[model samples]
Target chain A: MAYTQPHPRLSVVSNSSHSSVDHLSPTTTSRFSLPSVPSLHSSITTTKPGPNRPNIYDRPLNKTRSAEVSASAFAFLFSEVVQYTQKRVSGINDLERQLNTLGYRLGTRALELMVWRAEGSSKAPKRELKLLSVLMMVHTQVWKAVFGKGADALERSVENPDEYMIIDNDPLIERHISVPRDMSQLSCSSFTAGIVEAVLDGLSFPARVTSHNTPTVQYPNRTTILIKLEKSVLEREELLK
Target chain B: MAIFSLWVINKAGGLVYQRSFADGLAALTSNEYLVLAGTLHGIHAITSRLSPIGSSSGVQVIEGETFKMNILLTVTGTKFVLITSIKDPTADSVLQKVYDIYADAVMKNPFHTPEMPIRSEGFDSRIGTLIGTGQT
Candidate 1:
């Protein structure tokens, strides 16, 4: 309720400042005096004390694109997250599932933020109405925004019409993570798979996404994110076609 | 220019990881390796105390006839010891790189417990490649 309410005091201050500017003559003395009113008003409004800290929504979205966390720092944080998830799980699969759940929450937020960023201040933001277009967007824009590079490949499965894959030669999430001999089946990229699934789900695609370690001799950390669409989605696609 | 071996000791003077690159050095048993780590850790502490200046860092470089040992003690008390050829000038730099790799591969590993023996294949292969490149 507090957040939804517009600041009456702020609007009143701004209105008075605008009216004052109109009354002032276009002289150097007026110009010098003019800044003092707005500056005083701004200083009072901007520097709100204690609990009135600006929320994320209050901040500008178009921040520096080049802003990055050091890879080592991310690795350390991710490692701790994995270890924390591992503590509560019964087995490797359970651990991966928990990690996926953790990523799913992040995915929803990431999708919304990505869409918002793409829309900018445009009155009419374009939406991906088709399946292929949405997948391409994820494979390119979403992947680039999240991992700083586009996925290596996106291909539809030959056997399954509803199945698709997004391949990354070296997924950034698992770059430093090496699965031990006993847990060779465990792919840390399952977290990324969850993110992809959430993105699709957010767009009403209703798909299940999973990550597989499809390593080659050249790229030992190669990962393929497998997406399986629901029957309803496929039927809708056909209807749209 | 040739690196012979590397050893990592945890804060409590336990051998967490050990690897030998060269072939000429006589092989020691696993127990001996642990003992060696503990002995070196003790000597390090003793040497630091022996220093005339107050609160000096312990034995960093131990020079021998055939090989030299360079020790890097991290802020967290983890020790990285590199054994290189007697005349090798890049031992310190190589140790620093090894520390970087250890921080990345071992410390960042989700499966790795703090101060535990590191068994990650990524750490092994990277170190192997690093030492291998250094040899050539």
Candidate 2:
């Protein structure tokens, strides 16, 4: 039997006979469906305001907790970054400076993450207050975390009291990068230099850091990251001693 | 197994890089080399279309009486052609290694522009060492 008109409440209750409800006038059904429309719209709008997807800030900061990315992937990405920076800059120095600036941002983030991870560990976190200890932390902890190994050597410059150097026998970033003969002066390790500079800067040890290609007979890709502490920093170090 | 030479053709069928290992090989002028690369690229395309069962990768291994040429076409259309001795069984493996090196050295070098001639000193040295080991 055809029911041309049915109560909205009865139609909702008798969902099994949905085909009969199709015979009802479109205007009547639309009017009845209008009440549920607001609820559906409200639900969608609620989800829109606060998405179920996790934010980056909510993620764990511990390095060990995260999956390690392949070195080749990093190499490919670093290569592209260098190329992108190369196009924007004028001279090799300008390119290095720009790369250094980019690395500085990474260094700040790395420092914060490392500190957080260290605090999360079992051992009581010891604050690095002195210049020597801070340099040691960078040479050991920072290098180990970033490059998977400690720096080869850390030495104070005999000629200059304020100057120090951290030597890396083979810098990871420079492994596949071969600077052309024409631009032999350009060292990609300037990025790492920036990282070291940022770490020092963040720790309130103001210093200028620059990377130089210091190849030897044994190590072809040896890089020396020179750290030149400011006069104020040296004076503070003397007071601490 | 002795590798005679290597040629790199960009996606546009242009000769981008070439290196010769053995001495006493016939030397072609730069212009002649470009023409040779273009001819080989054209031949590969034509042969792929000529396959009986749908399209196939063309002219993979071209064997001469004394030498054999192995062509490796990457997904991006760059071709790495390695010419080795006819008796060499490891030509394909060597070609694979060459491709890996190209991806690392040439592609990774900021100084190297895509589809241009590769003049990377590191690439040259690494390729030399790789092919040199194969020769010995």
Candidate 3:
């Protein structure tokens, strides 16, 4: 974490005493074998050992699952979520925004895990063009993971072309929400919106997700999240076969 | 069995809400309603304390003119007192429907405080519909 401004190789020679073996590691290749690291370009220039350096991304993500959690436990947890967004917001729109962001972030991690735990392992896509298909897969799979069922509906916006909406009836988290008072504007299911955004970003879809209230009998809190794709993504999609 | 109105008592025995669906039951002043809630809360608490297992099957069957205000309660010990003057015997189901509406509109509402006064629009409106439901 200590990111000191690294002095140039020529400048370090001015400190003549401790500079004897200043740049020896790269200059003198001993028995240490280092693989070709693209981001490790500056390693050859460091005169002093960058303290406490270890590869951070080398560790696995899923450390462990809590032994006690079950289906009922999730329902209660979802109840708490319904309560959490109750206060500390302006109106229904803000509440929905918050919920959308939560859902989107959860979507990100869920997408990665879903792909990893699939019947066939997935290779993470590197380019934007190959990512829309991945994005669709993420919407379908990750929605099923968190919401307990696949999304009720999905459609691209006709006029805008870049906008899309993923519909969910009876989002489990919203089952317990009974928004009160001046906040009777919308359900507090914006947490789901966050999870959706997370999945989109994780799959390199790069879109914004906002939850809209669309209530039906079987699906009271039918959230239709409008996702507006970034221009770069549209261009990439057009370029791809 | 019949009901004419509904009242909810908080855990501490405070009467937070009261609404009459029928004509037999008279309205109480705001302060009187509060006093009533407190008294009922006390009674429910005293009854619960009488139990060895710490559960109160709260006060029911407050008989009135050609009508009755029967009480049901949530598992959390909050009272749901319903008043009805209906001649039909199937009055219990009406109260259950009230609870269902409460659970969906009020309990599911993030803005609703559990065991507090029922102030949700969805809740109040739905209850209004349930009360006048075939009572022509």
Candidate 4:
């Protein structure tokens, strides 16, 4: 279920607003209240419609259709996208950044969709409080939704508590992309890193995601996404505990 | 009637891939395959430009006595060519399915570079299975 508890401060402020109105209705002591209900109603109905707009949240995702798409269609579209983005970029880094930005937007929406989907199932969608739980969710649920399979591994840095790694033997986004020798440093998996960053950021876990080429014997395109959490988040995490 | 083979040509008219599903078609040298791909690309480009009706740059079908070739070109110029026995009606759908797999196994593969030859064993085996060939 969605987080239903209102903040303590929010309730205090709303009650004060109701009290101010209550003073005016002292003569009629029936005590009828329409305080927070109207505001909630307005927020729900405020979504405006445009002719070609498709709202992702309006209806439940079609179970069978929502999860899969023609990979060829996606590849062709992604190729054109890379080509289009490439024209304006001065270097490989810039191109990768642009692609990351594209993936970031997708990640934000995907998180919402995934959370919504999770709610429809038996398990209650939990707030990402624990670091391990969040990483597990990303490594399993998020990875599966985006790539059609779970990431191969999730591990914490032995040297640093703030650093985490999500490894995929074969990242799907890099399937067609072969970086040139000159741009060997470039990893198109940055788009996927952007997705990971956005997902963590969505849950207020500020972190940097960098994709590294870790070629294993079995997984040549083996990608390890390093997540470095912000100091503030680590501090807050400690306080929460 | 059955589908026999599939070919993928990049926008530059280079043959990136070619696979034979059935044994009747004549085998050519790898260089010959490249020439065939390049020639087809040139002809397709010229046909689109020379269309009397204008702006229709698509090559839909090419019929031979024994085989029919169906071509599906993406908006970005990647062409999928499927050759089949003349009476096979499912060539278009098969090509479309192959296109989807290409996007997945090759395009999405990080090791695969655009406009480069596909060497991914995953793509090879998937296609092999799809076309009823046990061999990858």
lDDT per residue (tens digit) for residues B1-136 in model 4: 7777889999999999998888767888999989988998988988888777858866789999998889899888999898888888788788888887887777765456789887776687678878774122
TM-scores, all models, native as reference = 0.84, 0.85, 0.65, 0.55
For lDDT, the strongest prediction is 1
Off by over 4 Å in 2: A1-53, A63-66, B133-136
Candidate 3: where are CA atoms >4 Å away? A1-75, A82-101, A120-139, A184-187, A215-220, B22-32, B43-58, B73-75, B86-105, B125-136
lDDT of 2 by residue, B1-136 (tens): 6778899999889999998887535779999999989999999888888889987988999988888889999999999998888888888888899899998888877778899999987788789888884474
**What lDDT would candidate 2 get against the real structure?**
0.86
**CA lDDT of every candidate:** 0.88, 0.86, 0.65, 0.81
Full candidate order by DockQ, most accurate first: 2, 1, 3, 4
True contacts kept of each: 0.82, 0.79, 0.64, 0.33
Q: Candidate 2 chain B TM?
A: 0.93
Encode model 3's per-residue lDDT on B8-116: one tens digit a residue.
7766677767776655556778898788777766766666567667664645656655766567777776777766664645567777887787667665555667766
TM-score pick, better of 1 and 4: 1
Clashing pairs in 4: A72-B100, A174-B109, A174-B110, A175-B108, A175-B109, A175-B110, A176-B107, A176-B109, A178-B113
Runs of candidate 4 exceeding 4 Å displacement? A1-58, A62-66, B1-136
Listed models, DockQ each? 0.65, 0.68, 0.30, 0.20
Q: What's the distance in Å from true for residue B75, model 3? A: 5.1
TM-score of chain B of each: 0.94, 0.93, 0.77, 0.92
Rank by lDDT (best first): 1, 2, 4, 3
Give the per-residue lDDT of model 2 (tens digit) for A1-241: 2464566558666874675566566756785779787678778877664555545676556645445668888988899899999989999999889888988998998888788888898488878999889999999999987888899999999999999999999998888888887788888999999999999999999888888899998888899999999999988878888
Residue A95 C-alpha lDDT in model 4:
82
Ten contiguous residues with the weakest lDDT in model 2 chain A: A58-67
